[model samples]
Target: MFDVIIIGAGVSGVSCALILGSAKERPYALNKKIGIITHQKASSLQTAVFNNAYGIPAGKLGSELLEESLAHLSSTYPQVEQIEKEKVISIEDDKTFYKIITNKNVFESKIVVVAIGAGNPMTIEGLEDFVVPHQKVPAIKNRIQLKNNDHLVKDGLYVAGVLAGHRSQLSIAAGSGAAVATDILSLWNDGNHTMVHDAINK
Candidate 1:
């Protein structure tokens, strides 16, 4: 079981893993490889998007930041592993941690961060019936009430970005990731897992 399994390899998930896995005194000091389960391929951030949004000279864009981040992530934490092109179907608890069941493999982690914003499954009527369940058959308004449903046995689960149901921007997602990581780390420290507890606990 991994120390932490972060879903969705978007900016939020990556940022969290980047920060938490790089800690020094942590036993899992090497990143947990933080399971990356996504249905969609992590789109290369268009340099145009950044440039157009932030006036970044329009030329210094395209996968550079992501490339650098990925490189740094690899070089900085030599032990952390990254599994791309994996889509998680469901997250169930395995006593102490969560088990992520994907189409290709299964991963377990003490903590789970759900950063799948609009990426989560949605039932559409016309053509995308197979995407989600019960497309034509309707009950009321929203089909399933997923407020407090936990069939899994995990103890710690965090939600961020759109998955957290917050209409968040890039910076907000980054902060949210930090906050969730801090919370999980706090719990980990309390569980006598690491030295990064004080920063999170306080």
Candidate 2:
């Protein structure tokens, strides 16, 4: 079983994966089996331009940002598995681990983060009870977000990115993802706050 599984490929999802999979510092790293399942598309792809994102160059395509993020995660943390072009059908809590059913395969994990964005509402069995209207974007009807407390939907499950009720901004979504990962790492570190800081070799 994987230690954690993230269900999205947007900026938020990729950011979470980057933090959780980082091997820069051993004491702060999770060093667990992690997997990210994606449909190979993110709502950010629809964005015309991403100029306000902190640290990102102005006038860059959203797709380019996503590509670079994915490339960075892959090259930096090759141990994190990426399952692409697959749709997650449902998630079942098995007491000990979560049984994730996808159109292509079945996987089990100790924790799951839902960062599927707020564009189209995708229904997953057993998660409907937490569904609520997307209040951040009132003009977008039918958009939804999961009820969460500090990104935690319930024990072992979390909601991040715009789906976690954050504004649909690149920096906000990415930061939310990293925050979720830090929370998970804290749990692994016995409730102590943990952070990953890489020191450059001089």
Candidate 3:
């Protein structure tokens, strides 16, 4: 079991995981199968480190921030692992731990962070026959589960990053990941075992 489990390898997930690492917290990432998971890539959302006062820089953000975050995490904790190329089927929570099931593996952790680019898939009635129904995790309030399904757990799941922003930029996603981690760490150390929110929809 992991102390924390972060989903996706995007800036949001990666950056946040790095912070936990820096704080001496060991975390795991359930990304795709790394090598087999085609096109699993990362881009820094640093807004071009140096840009004109007029606007955001259009340059490609590299590994600077991510590298720095990694350095901190590596220095603080020695056992952080990034699991790649795994498609998550669902999440189950029971206050003490979250069980994450992927196509190839299953992982257990105390905190579940959702930094996935967007919310999960949603299924509708009319398009049920025409297209495959996309399922969203259940029990999401602070987190947006793209699906209308009712089977997702309501506790121990944190929905943040691109999923929270309906139409925000990528930079927001990066910060969201870190922010979610901050909240989780805060609550974890405060002796509060709740999921950070009183209600899933409120």
How does residue 66 of candidate 3 score in lDDT? 46
Question: What is the overall TM-score of model 1 with all chains considered together?
Answer: 0.65
Model 3 score (lDDT): 0.49
- Ranked by TM-score from best down, the candidates are 2, 1, 3
Cα lDDT of model 3 by residue, 1-202, tens digit: 6767776665567656655554442222222111111113433243435232123355434445445544555465445675656766666655688677777887788767665554324211111221222223233432233331211123455655555443345556656666766666555556443222234786
lDDT of 1 by residue, 84-115 (tens): 67876777766687778877887888777776
TM-score of 2: 0.92
What local lDDT does model 2 show for residue 92? 96
Candidate 3 positional error at 125, Å:
17
Candidate 2: residue pairs that collide? none
lDDT of each: 0.54, 0.84, 0.49
lDDT by residue (14-128, candidate 2, tens digit) is 9999999874355645468899986755455656587788998899887776677778888998899998888888999998899999888999999999888875656577788
- Tell me the lDDT of model 3 at 34: 13
List clash counts for every candidate, in order.
4, 0, 12
lDDT of 2 at 10: 82
- Among all windows of ten consecutive residues in candidate 2, which has the lowest summed lDDT? 22-31
